[model samples]
Target chain A: MNILVLVKQVPDSEALVQVKGEGSGVEVEDRYTLNFFDSLAVEEALQIKEQTGAGTVTVLSLGGQKAIEALRTAIAMGAAEAVLLEDPAFENGDEYATAKALAAAAKGMEWDMILCGKEAFDDSSGIVGPLLAEFLGIPLVTTVVKLDFISEEQAVVVEREIEGGKEVIKAPLPVLLSAQKGLNEPRVASVMGVMKAMQTEIKKLDLAAVGLSQSEVGKAGSKEEILRYHRPPERPPVTMIQGEATEVVRQVVALLKDEAKIL
Target chain B: MAGDVWVFAEYQAGKIRKTSLEVLSKGRELAEQLGSGLGVLLLGSGVDGLAQELTAYADTVYYGDNPLLEKYNNDVYYQIIAALAEKEKPHILLAGATFLARDLFPRLAGRLKTGIAVDCLSLEMGDDGSLIARRPLFGGKVLADVVCREGRPQIALVRPNTFSLPDVQSPAQGKVLPLDVTVDTSQVKLEVLDVTRMAKERLDLTEAEIIVTGGRGMKGAENFQLLDDLADVLGATVGATRGVVDNGWRTHDDQVGKSGKTVSPKLYFAVGLSGAIHHVMGMNTSKVVVAINKDPQAPIFQYADYGVLGDLFEIVPLLTETLKKEI
Candidate 1:
């Protein structure tokens, strides 16, 4: 089994985002990390390789050279190799264009299974995994919570979560699955692993090299555009209560009826 | 550009979801702001009467009566809505950020080659004649304002409960524009084999009027029974913070946080959870936020309308009993 895991470098969850100018979108000054969810994908792929002991795990990413950190993180987590579709040109690609680029990269790989975070932290569209699967003309399952090997060549069974409940679906190999949080608990890289990861080779691919153009990858390729960006209005000071539970409830109900008027 | 603002009035079973009305209300406001007509796109089998209800808030109502659209399919609904938007170039497109909307909007935007802002918490008109949309990023840790600069007739999926539904209903005298949309069923590849509803009564957390949620301080999964008891008595749904969900005590659907569902219940009761921004984003829209936590330093009180400094284990049970007795 040759499992491919896709990861993206995102602004760290703790980093503050600022919107500048009248319509400029969010801008983060400093600090970024591997998407918290994609880290889980990397962990899951490494676990699959370790447990099976037969498959090679490849970590793929689309971002700048700085995104090599994301690939290295996956490598330190035990991925056999790393592929970075890194280029300044790939910047600002919307979900559709990003998925297309990823699909193009996958077209050249000898992948039997693909796993990715359900969505990138920056975009949060959650459409790329399925969209790339569509572009690749393969079966797609998203929000996968659990996975089990049914057979080597025939199929794999996984739980796909939806709104209310989850569906356990068995699909043939070479399928694409997007993982959600809690699919697996990711382990921290050891000193030795980190040292080894520094030496791992990262294959870089640009737009034209990936069978695409500048117009096909970035803001130009996106169907949607960010017209304007701004900060949310500061919320009013909270109307706090200083009394017993019963008294507080009464005050809350009053405020809701009179001030908030939602009830 | 010539058409009115269109609200996707989503109805499941017979009754319309509250989010649908909220969208209509927001769309009506936007249409008025833009000096355009208000229109609603209603799709479902046996939904002709629902058209009247939608028309109560809209100037025009377009009904697409098809059984295939009764239960939403991403491809089917996307095709229908995309075709409608093409024919009727509405200035602004608004829909609830429900599961149906999440599935259809991005795909439809891709198919139409338009831009969309998803899960917007607030929508307002910009000074420059563009629609400014506020959405959360970094798991609701930060609220990012976004706008579609280039797309014709900007598209957005409004988060549930962010906007209030207007009490004043318009006269149900709008024109019913029944659309004759061709359905290519073969294009819909995914089949819904079955829908197993989660076990519970009342409403889901996202759709609930009142939500009573507990966190890890509640102790164990079994302790959630008290929260459920309170929810039952108040005609509310039970929700949990990420702490509880991560403990494998409850399903992720029950989680109230940035990664989980964003709920805007009328009244939200937070028990034992220290308010993380992620958790607060889910319920911050509630008209009344009452928090019960032993630690005064818990961040929940900062956002909470009412706070109780006591053991939630004791307070929740007492409150539940007292409310049950009073009501």
Candidate 2:
């Protein structure tokens, strides 16, 4: 079994996002890391490969030159190899075009299953995995928490998180599953693994190599164009309450009833 | 067979979810703005009766009743919705940014080769007959104003609690139209083995109106009972900071921060948690924020509407007791 783990690199969760150029763009500090959820995907893919003993986990990502760091991190963890889809044309694409490019690249690879985070921390659209499945005409199960492979049946059963609880689903191989929270406790890379990953060569693919033209992969291929970005407005000043616990409680309850009127 | 504004209603547990109604209400507003008809699509088994709740808001309620839809099959729902959308060519389509919608609408848009914005905070009509949707990206720190620069049936999945439910109309003038859809068994590959929703009364954080959240300051798993007690009294759902969740004091479902669920509730309580930017990004849209922390310098106090600088162990029980007496 060959598993493809789709990953993304994003600003550190603790990093402050700054909007620049009159909303033309936003900039974050240099701090960067693999998206928290995508790490779960990496962990799940690695666990599957280790337990199955007959499969390979190759991490794939689309981004600028920095995204290679995320792939290397995945390799440092346990992936056998990594591929970086980096090209000027692939930048600024929305979910539709993103899946289009990924599907284009995926067509050339042999895989039994594709895994990715349910949503990336930056966009939080949760669209690519399902869109990729649609582009490939395969089934997709999202927010997956548990997965088991039925090798003999050539199918898999997955437990997916739903609105209220969970659903156990059965689908054929070559399906796509998006990792959700509680999927697994991701493993940290060891010193030896990190050293090995530092020397590994990563394969890079551009629009032409993937057989996608300039129009269908990036900003030109995107459906929705971001008009602008505005920093969220700050909330009003807080009304501080001090004194004894009883008095503070009284003030809060009264405030909720009269001023805030939310209670 | 036609409507300019279409809302895909989500029905679960025998009732239409509140987010669907909220989106319907917004759809009604958009429909009025365009002076066009509003239609709602309801697809599920035994959901025909739920159309009555939607009829007040939509001019027409289009329903496709089938057993295959009893539990949401992503493929079946997509098949049914995509075919109808192709035939009718709706100008705008809206659905709640839900577990179902987040998964379904993107695929729907992909198949239709159109544009969709998910987890939007607001939606408006653009000058070009397009939908202008404001969404928070990079978590809640940034708000983006975007539009589907080209396509028809511009799709958007709006976050719940962003809009209010419209008042039900007396003598409902809306009509119900049943759809003729056949279940294509060949396309259905995913099958459900079992479903477990442990507690019916416990609400999902996204849909909860009031939330009482704990953080690392809660100390340990045993202390979350204080929050549970307070939550029990106020009928509010409990949430946690990622730190507490990672510390094993709470489940990921109870986590409300970046990397967890983004919640927009009416009233939010930040208890024993020094607000981190990552945590605040998730619940920043809350209408009323109340912070309780012994430390006066906690950053959470900045974003809070009401701040009580005191020990949560003492303040929480007293607040609950006081609230109970006052009510």
- DockQ of each two-chain model: 0.38, 0.80
Error of 1 at A99 (Å): 3.7
Candidate 1 TM-score over all chains jointly: 0.85
Deviation of model 1 at B121, angstroms: 1.8
Candidate 2: fnat, from 0 to 1? 0.87
Local accuracy of candidate 1 as per-residue lDDT tens digits, B125-177: 88765788877666555566666766666778887777778554655667788
Q: List the residue pairs that clash in candidate 1.
A: A223-B114, A224-B115, A227-B147, A227-B149
Q: What docking class should model 2 receive?
A: medium
Q: Local error of candidate 1 at B7, Å?
A: 2.5
Predicted candidate 1 versus true structure: per-residue lDDT over A1-263, tens digit per residue: 78999988887655677766764656785778788778878887887777777879998988875579999988888888898887677788777778778988999998888998877776576777766776776666667778776555546777666656665666677777778775888899988889999998888888877888888787777755555555654556665555676665566555656777655
* Candidate 1, CAPRI quality class derived from DockQ: acceptable
Best by TM-score: 2
